[model samples]
Target: MPDKPAGMRFKVRNENKNALGGLATRKQITIYFTQAVDAPSMEVLLYLPNHVSGPVPAFAGLNFSGNQSVHPDKGIFMSDRWINNNQKGIQRNRATEASRGSQASRWPVETLLKNGFALVTAYYGDLEPDHADGWQTGIRTSLQQELNLAPDQWGAIGAWAWGMSRIMDYLETEKRINSKQVALTGLSRIGKAAVWAGANDARFALVVSNESGEGGAALARRNYGETIAQLNRSFPHWFSPAYKNYNQAPDKLPVDQHQLLALIAPRPLYVCSAAEDQWADPQGEFLSAVHAGPVYQLYGKTGLGTAQMPAIEKPVGETIGYHIRTGKHDINLYDWQQHLAFAQKHFRKKAKPKT
Candidate 1:
């Protein structure tokens, strides 16, 4: 992983007032590694609680569509970045006002603000778009020499994970945000990025995976839904070129995803799944957490306390939280509610003084 950039700062393009009816303040920030205008930059949308007495806990993650699509705020700077053509409210591969707040249901900004948690999100495309050719326009090429990965090294997910670290750099500058309490969260493929980010950067404090099966928290050896062969075939750029060798041969690999979860030992990790999202292998998701228990035990911390999956909609586990909601393959209010509850539990523990 790249060392945290020194002298990193963000420029406040505009501050939107009366956001969520005065419950929070919104800002669109353009972040840079240095003062050079031509250098690569990332745009992040921040929603900070107005009623909190001190620095608030926060969620830092990547958005699927665009920053503008997270909320229907006319004040939000329409993202000039490339977007998927099939995305709602987008036309000509660019964001339009019509696409505003289209994914707001997944975000639940008001709940975060009401519960005294700040939320910051950036368009994943800002780092690297999802297509095979996306790296040509995003930060991948610009960071090639900087990253210096081998031919077998994967840049796609790593690039997006690196972007999350950049977001952490920006969060450290915000006085109203308790950077130490920040949780990195994501859904689907981005959830895979979230785990990779948390594993590499301990500064994340907390990591939440919402239905990030397969290449994410799920064990490839399980031979469950969404096989390794399918992932590389469907999303060829998501993994390293060498990973293709493991296709249909997960057992031949030296390790399974339980080892990946072990990397987050002693820190809080939450694995979420949906009952109906069979393709994501909800059971395999729970089992990975169960198998990772030994690592957490080494630190005198807890992993998922049981090998058996919890009843649907009944969240379980201690430092390692796991849940399977009775729904489809999507992020919903139920998922956020459990995350807020889990964050409050672990983060509050850290806030306490020890004897």
Candidate 2:
């Protein structure tokens, strides 16, 4: 058996930008950063609560495409970086269209605003689409030399996580946001990125992973759906070259997704899956959550409240939350509903001051 890697520490860094300075006492401020990508640059979607007489909590995630796709907001301009579905950049494995605008409905924006929180998101495509050479064309190109020394230098997953960190940079500039109370979230591949981001940046108060299979919340040793070999062949650029060698040799790999989950220990973490999404291995997802629960327990917080996986549509709550909803491989309103409810239970609700 290979020795597991010790949990690594990371520091967050973002360019100084109070760009939205005075845009609003407490209002939404969206900013676009020009990463090294050729066509479309990256954008940050922000929702700042009406300035409470105090700072408000927030959640962040990586969107699948450009921010424009999220809500069809006329305010969001068309992205030049949009990779054609049949063309390059993992657009080949496009998500179901219905999933779009669906997340907005389930997230209960009003619930969050009323409860004193804000939400922010970034399109992962801007950093590096899940493909070979994705790193050479995106922000990672600029960061290669600095990050290459380490054997586990950031790969596709690291690039996406780095993008999340950049979003954090923008969040810090907003006076209305309590950067200390921010949560990082994502689904599937981006879900994996959220875990990496939260682990690397302690500033992220919470982490939520939904259907992040295999390299995500699932134990690699399980060699379940989306095995290392399949991942490399399908999305060759998402992981380091070192990861490729471990395709059929999970037992020999130094790390498993459970350790990735554990990396978020002592911090609030939630893992969710769908019953029908067997390819993503929902069971493995739940089991990994169960395994990581012990680490959270070490810090005096409840990890998962139980050991057995619950039925679809039935969510078991704990500091380390887990759920298996009825669906396929995609994020649904049901998932967002649970996430909002979970966030409400654990996060502090900052009340707006009297007029």
Candidate 3:
């Protein structure tokens, strides 16, 4: 593992057994920096399969809505934290009871539990909200003050990625989780964060991106859909101020998404897209994975060998995986199934047997 970043601390706020009808156990963890007593803290929800005998592999990621939205359990905290007001079940930056379990279909908690994997999630808003001024209300503000970082040093995506790393740090201490086998995953913008987190932290055994185009797994030079100009204009806070300079000419940028994928070389990475989600540039994402093949080859590992994208629902690759499923811009059981299968292929040998 890489050298641990400085000044991080974790505390388990609460834990309960027989959560979700005895299907799993749940723990609420708090992560903060030790340098500043007033530093912003983040809340993470961890669910472990109840029937599993020993430490199990887990999937960790940031969620778009409140933690309660992932499952119907009322025990899950309802986020009063800042969030994109546009999301369902959210109004005026707060989550309503109606929003609970709104995203359950996409999470597939039951399937994960049945398959003997743990699920760890945190609301992205707990790191930073999805607006330009969101930094003022989230971890970025405290981190900037504590670390003495300049405003342009990082952005919302970086903060979210850092939150994921903090979660991993806490997982390393858990006796019921195989921290080394934990996979990082997310959808759309959060998916971009997952890739960035995996790129920066080698602790993650697998990384999965679901329709994370443009600044994610898709080549910015392709300019197929959601160009730099549009993204910078629509979501200026997503990247650093320096990133805006490339809006008019992406080719001039020093790096592209292919290089981002290459950063995760030798580690299993999966990039998924939807057929109707052209705004994510499905072809561009596949091409980036293809371009990253040589880097994997440097480690004596195979990447997605085909220059062409595969048929709908047909996932391809060894160390690198890509697929454009038959649907729109949303994660469903199909995407999760592929991710679970990929994790099984790479982690099964190291996984502890279930009692």
Evaluate model 3: give its lDDT: 0.87
| Per-residue alpha-carbon lDDT of candidate 3 for residues 1-355, written as tens digits (9 for 90 to 100) | 1233377778888788988899999998877765468657788899999998999999999898888899999999888787667778888878999889999988888888878899999998888888888878766675665556655677888888888888888999999999989999989999888999999999999999999998899999988899999998998888888888999999898888989999998999999999999999999999999999999999999999778779988889999998899889999988888888888889965343322
Candidate 1, residues 1-355: lDDT per residue as tens digits? 6654554568888786678778889988998755566767789999998887788889999998888888887777788888988989888898878889999988998888888888999999988888887777666676555555542366578888989999998888888889899999999999999999999999889999999999899989998999999999988888878888999688898988878988988899999999999999998889899998999999999788888888988899998999998989999988998888889898873322111
Clashes of each: 1, 1, 0
Top lDDT prediction, candidate number: 3
- Order of candidate numbers by lDDT, starting with the best: 3, 1, 2
| Each model's Cα RMSD | 3.4, 7.0, 2.6
- Which 10 consecutive positions of candidate 3 have the poorest summed lDDT? 346-355
Q: Give all TM-scores, in the order shown.
A: 0.95, 0.80, 0.95
lDDT of 2 by residue, 226-255 (tens): 898998888877878888888778889876
Residue 78, candidate 1: alpha-carbon lDDT: 81
Please, what is the whole-model Cα lDDT of each candidate in the order they appear?
0.86, 0.68, 0.87
Candidate 3 wrongly placed segments (more than 4 Å): 1-7, 35-38, 349-355
Model 1 misplaced stretches (Cα beyond 4 Å)? 4-8, 150-152, 349-355
Clashes of 2: 1
